[model samples]
Target: MYPFVRMFYQAWKNRNAPKLGLFESHHSRHVCMPWDIDLWLELNNGRTLTIFDLGRVPMSIRNGTAKVAKDGGYSMAVAGASVRYRRRVTTFQTVDMVTTPIGFDDKFLYIEQSMWDQTGECCNHILLRGAVIKKRKLVPPKELFDLMDPTLESPELPAWVQNWIAADDTRPWPPTR
Candidate 1:
């Protein structure tokens, strides 16, 4: 089940947070609950992605994208992601999560997120490609930005992220063994 309550709480908690520009980071804090752990007694890999929602949604809200999405009758979806887990988070361990919009191409927006342990070490990081949907069609990032804030233009995507996207494009769909 989705953690709607926690998501709502995060939205409310950050309601007064300073508005962010396109390239600014949105910082949020979270803890590893019992349910978030796996049989190995650490935060589950899948749960990490789910928990990332807690940060990303609030980031959209803080940056005014959520409001624009709602008003425009659009929704955002994650199209692709690459993640790296470097450390284990045990039960009750607190982590500071940071989310930022790296940039967008014509079709997709790229977001970078990271979870840092209490001692300021990065535990995990993820790069996600997202698309906005409107009337069953994918809305280009430029169009979405025009609707949200015309003055705000997407920054250039980093070279590494562009490389990843290129690599993904080369992979054939419908795997053949």
Candidate 2:
């Protein structure tokens, strides 16, 4: 189940936050609720991804991408993602999440997010490839960017992210069983 209530809370909490530049980061805090745990009693890997949406969507709102998407009648979708889990996040533990737009290419907008424990140790990190869509068809990121700010240019993507992109390109789609 999606954390729709928590998502609304996050959005409401950040409604008055200062508008951020396209590449700026959005900082937020969240707790690992009982339902967020797995059989091992740690944050579930799948739930971690969903919680990431709590950060990304609000970040987009603060950065004006949400407005652009709304006014243009476009929707944002996650086309791909890669996550790395390190430390354990147990129930009731709080974590600080940072989300930032890494860059964009011709097709997709890239964003990075990480969750850190109160001790400042990173528990997990995720990289997302997002797409703008209209009428069920893909829309170029540049089109979205143009609506947000014509002068906005994508920052250089990190080499690791580029490598990940290159690697993903080699994968067969409609994956073989």
Candidate 3:
């Protein structure tokens, strides 16, 4: 149910777009309605991660990191993800999403989304792992890239997202089943 009016009309229609730098790529565009299908009708692996939060909140407001997490009080979450789908999107189809920012280490911030289709293919792909909270603690994506710019930097995290962050650091947290 969280479409929040298409994520507030895609954060006020990309709030003037343009910015994006920490590995820029915020393409947007979507569709597949009919309640985003399921029951074998297509597109619905958990509503494709809740429609990828309408393309990662307009790619975090066109990469200004949602205004440096709303002026540093901070609050970005998605602590982990890793989707893949390959095809099918039925109802009104459309797609074109994109979203980037594939770097950061001192505690999360690593994104990558896709979802092409309309002939270009790539029906799905995700790899998020964000974080930055502040008062509730956990806030170190290089301090949200030193509050959004500080000469940017963060570019190395790739070798397959550092082997999926070293295989999610050997998993095993409380799941002995």
Candidate 4:
């Protein structure tokens, strides 16, 4: 009877672990852990992962930029993503960042994000290629294109850049709700 009661008590206490962070162990400070924000936290930072997240797809689906839509707005489902790490980043290492919307075509949207260390060193980067589907088809409807093209078919990017995130022939986006 004593053993059963102790086991139940331990389980009950373990259920409410706010006193502990996700990876924090007993007596851990739980202060340096990172948050997986915007789904970009492929690293340990307490901030949201914006650019590598849906920033590219949303930018492509809405327009050549990550600019918010003017009408009722739009949502994008990421067809796929790929990231190539150039270097390692330790905890709390701050870096300068930049993002550029190269362009989009047919059923694919392409974007690139760069990260630079405090010393202006190129720390790492991610190349993203995604797709937009309105009804589970590769053919983007008039409304999607209408929303995308307001001024130019594609935006201009800086020189000295080349790595691109292109789409695979397979795996289309889920239909927009």
Candidate 5:
């Protein structure tokens, strides 16, 4: 598998150095969870967005133009995602997952995705926090933030966003997009 945030995080924990791109024994899997794809797809086409698009952001940060960008309103930035699994999921089976944007201050945008199988049982839940950066700064660039305004109103946000924000009590950040 290729080197990614999670794999590198684990490598840092294990005292294993990273090899550029991918390594045999260092990384195992790099599959994008469904929810992330949905947002990116929606951001592009707004009509035909799907789970496939949600999983493509890591590779699309640059040299990938959004399908629906008008001029320079949107651009890719730094971000990271983490997922927990209870059972193995095969690509053959389609799953139902609801996603929503929970919050976005200045640097971080939090999104939650919940997956349920055909039987209506929760299979996996994931939270993705993306930082919108430009030229290595923590502030959200004005142009990109304008594009994200339409996205913030998406119904995908789960019902528990407020609670999550309350629980998320991190370091005080008074700035925002």
Candidate 6:
């Protein structure tokens, strides 16, 4: 089951956070419960992604993207993502998550996120390509950014992200079995 209760708690907890600029970072903390673990007694990979959502959504709220989308009747979705898991997060251990907008292109907006364990070691990192939706069609990121702030100009996407984007484009859709 999706953690609806935790989602609500995060929203309520960060409601008064300062508004963030388009490229600024949003930080939050979370703990790994027994339910978040896998057979190895460490944070499950899938749940780690969900935890990243806990960071990103509240981030969108603090950065004003969520409000702009709501007011404009648009919604957001992750078009693609790549994650790297490097360390274990045992039960009851807390981690700090940092999420930031890296940049955007004509098609999608890119965001980078990472989770740091109590020891300050980065346990995992992910880069996501997100799309804004309206009428079941994708909305260009610039349009949404314009709604948030006309003065917003996307910073140049990092080379690593650019490479990943280009590489993803080469993969056949409906990938062959």
Best by lDDT: 2
Alpha carbon lDDT of each predicted model: 0.92, 0.95, 0.84, 0.41, 0.42, 0.92
Give the TM-score of each candidate: 0.96, 0.98, 0.31, 0.49, 0.43, 0.97
Candidate 3 TM-score, C-alpha based: 0.31
lDDT of 3 at 81: 91
Residue ranges of candidate 5 with Cα displaced over 4 Å: 1-70, 141-143, 147-177
Judging by lDDT, tell me the better candidate of 2 and 4.
2
Please, what are the lDDT tens digits per residue for candidate 2 over residues 1-177? 899999999999999999998999999999999999999999999999999999999998999989989999899999999999999999999999999998999999999999999999999999999998988999889888898788878888999999999999999997999
Model 4 Cα shift for residue 74 (angstroms): 3.3
lDDT of 3 at 175: 75
Residue 56 in model 6: lDDT: 91
Runs in model 6 with CA error above 4 Å? Answer: none
lDDT of 5 by residue, 17-108 (tens): 33221001111222334432333332112211223133333222221223223255344543645555544344444455454445455556
Per-residue accuracy of model 6 over 27-53 as CA lDDT, tens digit each: 999999899999999999999989999
lDDT of 3 by residue, 95-142 (tens): 888888878878888889988988898998999898888899886788
Backbone clashes in model 6, listed as residue pairs: none
1 against 3, candidate with superior TM-score: 1
Minimum summed lDDT over a 10-residue window in model 5 is located at 20-29
For model 3, what is the error of residue 122's alpha carbon versus the real structure, in angstroms, after optimal superposition? 6.2
* Model 6, residue 45: C-alpha shift (Å): 0.5
Least accurate stretch of 10 residues (summed lDDT) in model 6?
A: 144-153
Candidate 3 ranges beyond 4 A from true positions:
1-13, 17-54, 57-59, 62-65, 75-78, 85-95, 98-114, 120-122, 125-130, 139-171, 174-177
For model 4, residues 1-177, the per-residue Cα lDDT tens digits are 113332344334434444321112221011112442224434433232342342233223322322333242443555545555565454555555554545555556555666666666765565555555544555442345455444435433334222332224433556565
Clash count in backbone of candidate 2:
0
Say which prediction, candidate 1 or candidate 6, comes out ahead on TM-score: 6
